[model samples]
Target: SPFPVHINRQQVVHISGECCHCLRLNNLGIFRIHCHGQRGLIEAKIFNLSVGNHYDIGQKISFQLLESYEQLRQFPLEIFRTSLTILLTAQLRLVQERIRDLIVEEKSGCAIVSFQLFEIAAQLPKNEQVINILRNLIDKQAINLIDPNRRILHAICGSLVIGPKGESIDVKLFSQANGDYIGEFTPKKIGQYRIDVTCANIPIQDSPFFTEVYDPLQVHIGPLPKNILIGIENTLEINLDNAGNVPLEVIITSPSGINVPIKIDDILTMKKVHFTPTETGIHYLNVKFGSDIVPGTPIQMMVNNAHIISAYGDGIHHAVHEKEATFMIETKDMQGDLQVDIEGANSVIKTTIDRINNSLLKVTYIPVEVGFINISIKWNEKDIMNSPFTAIVTNPGNIY
Candidate 1:
């Protein structure tokens, strides 16, 4: 007869055969077969004591007739149990019906298997040799829906760490109330750190990630000029000497709530931010470092339009014909091109300008053709205060 069936759980069965008979389960060293003979009938069971699910599998149990105790020659059970040259077949055939017993799949980031299967494999009697041979082709299994509460084994887990080379930092890893896993690490120094994750003595997917540490406190911003002029290039310098490799953000808002475009240049070791204010009113400046506001940020700056500049000297009023006319211009901290225009002169008017200092320039022009020559001076494309001075020119007719 084929092997008996066990479903959901394990069952023990009694076996009796004709006199001088023997039973053997071939190639199943793991399956412990218990045999005992009484008078004319022999009794034996081939398999371990176990409990499983939906396992109505019937395997062929080969039987062979042997000379009774007379053939055993006393102590039959001992001698026969040791020298029972039993060679059984290792073939799995559906003794009767074709049934779908188990379904193997992966779900929820985990491999799903019958919970009862592990129970059977880990049973007592310690049949390691046989179980290993037939582990993949196990006896029976049940196709059950996934149930989180019936977790009999470990749910795939891993560990994560972030630190510098050969130096580990403190990391806090926890699960939130919403069941989301979160990780945090505090770096002690400003350097590159490696993130490692492992599971079951093996590296998990995407094991290593890199990160850098930065200190926002080391970022410093210099003082901005409280007063600035419109249409003039004003610059602010920022010092990030001790700060790590991080980014700095700056925003300049005009009086009309418009964001002014600013140019940032790296000058030696400092950052120079240059912006030209167009509106004459109160403007705001914003600065930040890695989502943290730097000290003295969002400062207030008053903007004033360029006013008329004053000019004086002998070159603008009276001059002798064919003589050089000279004048001095005070820039008053103003910036732009220095221009000079001479009118009422038919001949080309030659002009010369020499920069004496940061805010002073010397202007010279010679008038060959004279007719009340009008002179005009403009700074930054705009005329200065009291410009277009008229100069009297008279030819020195036949000077001695």
Candidate 2:
């Protein structure tokens, strides 16, 4: 007698028997079996099963079959059962151990993320297919990409080309000859960017990678006056912006090749450098921020000659007709002989100049008129302080 049993197509079923012969009939989708020298019957029913496209990894597919036999002489019937299970999995594996984060400058052309891929089995699909799988996984948005500050959750994988300010950027994917994958994109703004990688819809180890972009430092140098006088203290102001919280180094060189001391006040915002030039020529000021020189640096200043300090006269304000008047002159850093001149209303008053000291000059003159008296003092043709001094000449009797 024959017993009916059902089994799933392509599922293996075990039939246990000693000295039993079994034959597969491909045309009828059944197995023919015979027991040695014994009257036996076999019946098999098979059902076709289709696999769904949404299958997950490690999912199990199983089927079972039951068989029963009745003895020819009315012996007790025997039953047997068999089952099989198949697990679904892919051959893709992440070969690279760790992925590092990236750092880029603002307006940088591109950012690249590199990784390696290898297969778990030797009989897996070709490398092209594996690459396609990776591409498809990325295209399907299986990986999460975002900018936390912007609060944006990327919807498309390739479309994750945005800067810190939500600006459009260009992105690209590369296939390397050494079995490595590279993802690249250009950043228009500056900030932190995060990228996550996944394989077979599962997050890869060290999945999220961080990238930081920053803007370069900007600097500006002095508003120095075109003409700077010698022997006078002058202030050089340097306006530094975007110093980026770093200490600034500044240097000033005089025309005599002497380094001038500089003082930086309000270092963070406005910086000031005060220097007093001794010699007269073009002076150079060099300013540095870290290892780079600031823009418009090495400023040139035209230093002119020295000027007078003070000048006075004795008895010149109310000079007598026949009395002698003495005039004194003081200059800053003047060392040469001084030339003195005195002129009356109609005649030139004769005067004698005496170098009392290195920076001092004395002149003695006799007033011959009752009008205004003009005294001129010079050192190397340059006027001393108040060189053209005026003195009133009144009557000797009316003088106080």
Highest lDDT: give the candidate number. 1
Which residue pairs collide, candidate 2?
308-385
Best-performing candidate as measured by TM-score? 1
- Deviation (Å) of 85 in candidate 1: 48
Mind giving the per-residue lDDT tens digits that candidate 1 earns over 1-400?
8999877533221211121121111111111111122111111111221211223432211111212223223333433332222111112221212212222222222232211111123333222332333332221221111122332222222211111113444454443354233444444554344444333222333434444444566767765643366887777788776554456788999989999889999765489899998888888989886545776768887776655366788878877788888988887665566678877656557788998888888888888875788888876556667777888877778456
TM-score of 1: 0.39
Question: For each candidate, what TM-score against the reference?
Answer: 0.39, 0.29
Off by over 4 Å in 2: 1-218, 225-232, 242-244, 308-400
Model 2 C-alpha lDDT per residue in residues 1-400, reported as the tens digit of each score: 4988888554221222110111111111111222222221211211111111121211111111111111111221121010000000221343221111122111112222222222334534533464555455556655333232322232224422211112222434343354333444443333333343333222333333343332224555555743455776667676654333334677778767898766667755677777777878777877766445666777777776666346776654557675787866776554454677778888798887787877676778788888888877765555566667788787758658
lDDT of 1: 0.49
